[model samples]
Target: MSDGFECFKHVGLALDPIHVGTGGARLGRVDLSIVRDPVTKIPKIPGSSLAGVHRAYVAMAEKKYPGCAGQGQPDTSGAGGHCCDPKCPVCTVFGFAKGKDSTTGFTGLAAFSDVHIQLFPVATREGPLWVTSPEQLRIAGLSIPEDANADAVYRKSTSSQPLNLGWLLLPVKALSEHSCIRDELNKLGVPKHILDRFGVVPDRLFSHVVNSNLEVRTSVSINPETGAAEEGALFTYEALPRATLLFWEVTCKNPKHFKIGNKDIEAANNKDKVHSLVKKAYPYLEHLGIGGMGTRGMGRLRVLEPNASSNHSSEIEQSDKDKSQEARH
Candidate 1:
C-alpha cells in the first residue's frame, strides 16, 4: 500500500482572488505545491496542510471565544494564556495561540509562538510573490474582511485569520495518502470514536486516488527502419500521480467534503450560490461552529475550473457576439 514515498517534504500555497467588479476586489484563490527536497524541486502536494489549517482555525476560534482560555485547561500562570502556547509544539509548527497570561501577565509566548512557521516557504521569489498577491488574498479570503479597517486590526490580534490555514492548505489535499501515516495514527492509540469521525477508513482512502489525463506530444518516427516517417504527431493521455488527482477532486470538485481534524469541513462552500452545499446547509454549518464573520466568509471557494474554463470558453465568447448582433437588429 506504500508508494515508497513516505516522508512529506515540500509544502506550497497557491492563491486566486475574486474581483467584485472591474475596479473593486472581492475573492481570492490559493493552491499548494509539494516537494520532496529543495534540489529536485519536484513538488507533491500533501493533505495534512489542509487539515492542519482547518484544525488551527477551529482551535483559534475556541481560544478567542469570550471567557475561553485555551483548548484544554492549563495552569493560570503562563507566558501566553492559550492552552496551545507560542512555546507549545503545536503552535510553533502549525499556528500560534496567543492570549493574556493570568498569572504573571506576560505578553509573548516565548520562542515558539513568536516564529510563524509558514507551511510554505517564502524564501524563494515565487513563494514570496505568491503570498502577497491578490490570488493569495482571495484564497485566504483576506479581500473580504469583517470590516475593512476594523477586521484588519482584529486579524492582527491573532497570529492568523480563521481562513488562513484553509487557504494555505488548499493545494496540499491533492497528494493526501494513507500509508504509514494511518498505521502511525493507529499506533498512537487514537480512540476509534475520534478516528471514525475523521471518515478516514483505510479502504476509503482509495477514493482519494482519482484519475486525471494529461495530453503531451513528443517527436517520434513512424518508420524508423526505413528512415522515412510522417511529420505529424498523435495525442496521448496519461494518468497523473494519484495524489495530484485526489487533490483536484476534493478542492476542485467536491470541496465541501474537505475535512478538519475528525470534523467535516467546507471552507470553500459559498453561501450565496443557491446550488452550493454551504448555502443549502447554512443553518447546520452555523450550529456546528462553522460560521463566518461576514457573508463573504460563507465558505465560498474560488478555484480554477480548468475543465470548465476550456469547455465554456467558446460558448461564452459566442454569447458576446450574440449580444452585439441583437443590438444591431
Candidate 2:
C-alpha cells in the first residue's frame, strides 16, 4: 500500500492525418472506417493500439527487435521471444508473456488511456478553425460559464458574425472576457492561430461536426499482373486531419510492487522511472508514426511537453535537471 501509482497527461498535435481502422469495411460512406467510440461516435486511438506500438518502438530503440517487439512465438522447447528480463527497459516497462502463460505474465507498469480529440480543425469561410465542445473543454480541465447559451457557438474572436464549421454554419457569440478557456489553452501551449480561430459548439453537435470534416480519400489497388489499377478495387477511408490536437493519460505503477518471472525490476524502481522510460519512446513515435496507413502519409503525432502549471511538470523539470547534472559530470 505505498500509493505509488502516478498519472500523467499527454497532449499531441497531429503532424499528418491519423487513420486507426476498424479492420473491415463497413456499409457506410467509407469502405475502410476508422475506429470510433460507440457511445459518442467520435473516433479515437485505442489504448491497446498505443501500448502495442509503444512496446515495438521501445524494443527497437533498445535494439531488442523481433524478440521483444511482440508476443513471442514459442519454439519446440516452449520458450518465448520476450527477454522477460526484469532489468530490460523494454520488458520491464511493457511487461511480457511466455508460452501458454498462467504464471508467466505481467500486465506491465504503464497503462494508457484512449486518445481523444481535443481540438478538431475544420475549414471555414473566414479561414481554418479549430472546433471543440463544452464537454471536450471540461475534459481538459477548463469550463465555460454555467449560464452560457448551450445552443450558440462561443469564440475567442470579437466578431459577432456567423461562423462555418465544415458545412454547417452557426451565429457566433463572443466568449466572455473573463472566460478561462482561452487562458488554459494558452498554458497548454496551443498555437496562437489555432486559439484565435477556436470555437466552442454545443456538445450535441460536436460529433457531427467532427465526423463531417474528417479527411477522406479514395484509392485503388494496382494489379501486379498488368501494372494498372485493378478493377473493382477502389475504396475510401477517413482519418483525423492534421493540425488536430488530442490528449491521453498514462498511469504508471511502482515497479517495486511487481516481479517479472522471479526477477525484480531495478532499472525502473519507481513510478517516475517507469513513466520516463515510456516517454523516451515518444520521439520515435513522432518520426515513425502510429496507427494504420502510415505508408500513405498518415499517423505522425508530435507529443507536447506539459506546461509549468501541469501537475507533473515539477517532476519532469527535476528529471531534466538531474540529466543535466549527470551530463556535466
Candidate 3:
C-alpha cells in the first residue's frame, strides 16, 4: 500500500479463454504459433504477450495516450514526438520515452508477470471438469493433497478403452476428486461464485494433452482486385480454448519522484493514478477482450478480485450455492 515501488502487489487473475493466440506459426510442426511450456509442452500465456496487449489496450482507451512512435519503433519521433504532458495519465502510467538517447523517460510504474495456466477445462462422461496438477497449483502459492489421485477421467464403458479429452486420449483410470481441488482453491482466495467447474487432474496427463486440445483456426486473405482468395494468403493458427484458466500479477511501485517531461510528479500520486485506471479498465476489458483477433471474438478474460472483508468469503459461497442449485434444476 505504501508508495515508492517498494512493495510487490500480487494480483491473481483468472482468464476464461475465448480464443487467445499468443504466437503464430512454428517452423516445423505448426504453421502458426502455439507457444507452450518448453518442458511440460502445455500451452502458456507469456508475460510479454500479456504485457504488450495490456499496454496497447490501456493506451487505446484513452484519448491522450500517445499513438505509435513509428512503424517498428515506440520512440521513433524522439522527444518532440510525444504530447509530453507531465500530467498525462497514459504517459505517466505506461511510461514514455523521447529524444535520441531516451534516457529521461521514467520506467513504467507497474510490472506485469506472465499469465500462467491455473486450470485447463476438459470434458468427461460425468460432467465438465477443470483439470490441473498439484505442482501447477503449488507454483501459484497453493498446495493440494499429495496423495490425491491424479489420473481421473470418465469413460462410457469398462472395455479397457482410453478416455477421450477432446483431441487427446488416455487410458481410463481412477481420477482425482473435484472437491479436493475446490477446497484448496477456496483457501487460496478463489471466488467460488465464479466458474464452478474447476477440478484437478494428474500433472502428467494435463501436460501431455492440453496443448493438443488447442483450437486450430485456418484463415485466408482475399484479393481485392479480382475478389478471389490470394494465392499465398492461406494460413493456419491456434488459440486457447474457452474456459481455460490463466493467472497473472501486476506490481505497482510508489516512486519517490518521477518526471513527466520537465514536471515532477509525486510518487504517491503516480501509484494512485495507475491503480485507479486499472480498476476502471476491468469492466471495459470483458466487453473489449484482449490479445490477437479480438474482433473475431478471441481473448475475452474475466478477473476475480478478492476482497479481504469478512463478507467476501460468504458472498462468494452464496454465489456458488446459487450456481449449483441452478445447475441442478
Candidate 4:
C-alpha cells in the first residue's frame, strides 16, 4: 500500500469563461454543446481534460529545466523513448506512452479527478449569486450555508435576498435570519474577492441557474482569400460563463519502491518535485485554458492554490517547504 496511489495533493481551478467549446451536436438546437453532466446537465470540466492540460503545461515549463541531460524536451515524435529517463519530471508525472517508457517501471504518479461545479455563477434580480447544491457541497466536503434553504421553487436565502442576475427571479421563501455564506466559504479556502460575489442557493434552482446562465456564442470560419465568413460556416455554441468555480483533486502516488535500473526511486523527492512543477505551471492556465477553442479566446482559467485568504496558511507553508526541497535537487 505504501506505493499505491492516494490523494497526496489537492488542487482547484476557477475556470474563467473565454468561450470554451467541447463540440457536441444537439439534435436541432445549438451546433455544439459544452460538456455537461449527463444527469444534471450542468457544464463541467472533465478530469481527463484537466489532466491532459496540466501534463502539457508541465511539459512546456520543463523545457527550461530539462532534467539531468536534456530529458525535458517533449517527445516530438509522439513516439516515446525521448523521456525514458526515470528522473524526468514530465514523464514521471504523466506516464510515458506504451513501448516507450522509463526503464524503471512506473505508472503516471498523478491521478486527476473530474471537476464538479462548486460555486456556479448565475444572474438574478440582485446582481450575481453563486449557487451550490446539497449534493455538490457534500461532494466537495463543504457544508451548506445556514442562510440557504431548499424550496419547491428555489433554495432562497432568508437574510440576504437575491436581486437581479439576468432573466430569472429568486423568490425568497425563507423568513429566518442567518449569517452570510462568505465566512463559511472563507474558512473553506475560497478567496474573499470571489466569495463576496458568490452565495449558496438551493439545489432545486441550480439547473435553472446554470442552464439559463450559459454563455451562448456565435462564430464563423473565415475564407482566407475573401477575408470574410465562409459560406454557411456560421455556428453557435454554449460555454460555462466566466467566474465559475469548479474543483477537483489530484493524488500523487509516491512510488518509493519504483526502481530505475538498480536504484529505488525516491518517492518523497519525486512527489515533492511533481507538486512543485504543477504549482509552477499554474500561471499558464490563464493564458492557455482548457476544453476547446483556444484561438477564439475560449478556455483561459486560474488555478486556485491554498493560501492565506482561502485560510490555508499551513498548506501554503507546506508548498513553501516543497519549493525548498525542489531547490535542493
**Clash tally, candidates in order:** 28, 0, 14, 12
Tell me the alpha-carbon RMSD of every candidate: 25.3, 7.6, 5.2, 9.0
Stretches of model 2 off by over 4 angstroms after superposition:
77-80, 99-102, 144-149, 177-179, 309-329
Error of 3 at 247 (Å): 0.5
lDDT of 4 by residue, 1-329 (tens): 24455453243444556443465557646788777788887777777777777877776777723331233333667442445456666666765543344334445677787777777777665556666666677666655555456542233244455455466655554422212334445555566445545544566677777777788888999899999999988888877777777777777766574655565554236565556755655777877787677776678777665543554434544665898899999
Per-candidate TM-score against the hidden true structure? 0.21, 0.88, 0.72, 0.76
**Count of backbone collisions within predicted model 1:** 28
285, model 3: CA deviation in Å? Answer: 2.9
Among all windows of 10 consecutive residues in model 2, the one with the lowest summed lDDT is 310-319
* Best candidate (score: lDDT): 2
Per-residue alpha-carbon lDDT of model 1 for 1-329, expressed as tens digits? 12211111111112211111112222322111112213322222233333333334433443442222234344466433343332332232222233343222222111111001111211221121111112212232222221222211111122232222212221111112222222222332322222211211111111221111111122344676777765663222121121111111122222233223333322333212212321222232233322121232222222222222232323434665798799999
Q: Rank the candidates by lDDT, best first.
A: 2, 4, 3, 1
lDDT of 2 at 31: 93
Candidate 2: residue pairs that collide: none
lDDT by residue (130-195, candidate 3, tens digit) is: 666766777676656454354654222234666566666556543233444455456545655433
lDDT at residue 312 of model 2 (Cα atoms): 38
- Residues 219-321, model 2: lDDT tens digits: 9999899999999999999999999999888889988888776768876988988888898779988999998899999999998875566323344446658
Please list the residue runs of candidate 1 whose C-alpha ends up more than 4 Å from where it truly belongs after superposition. Answer: 1-13, 16-41, 60-314, 323-329
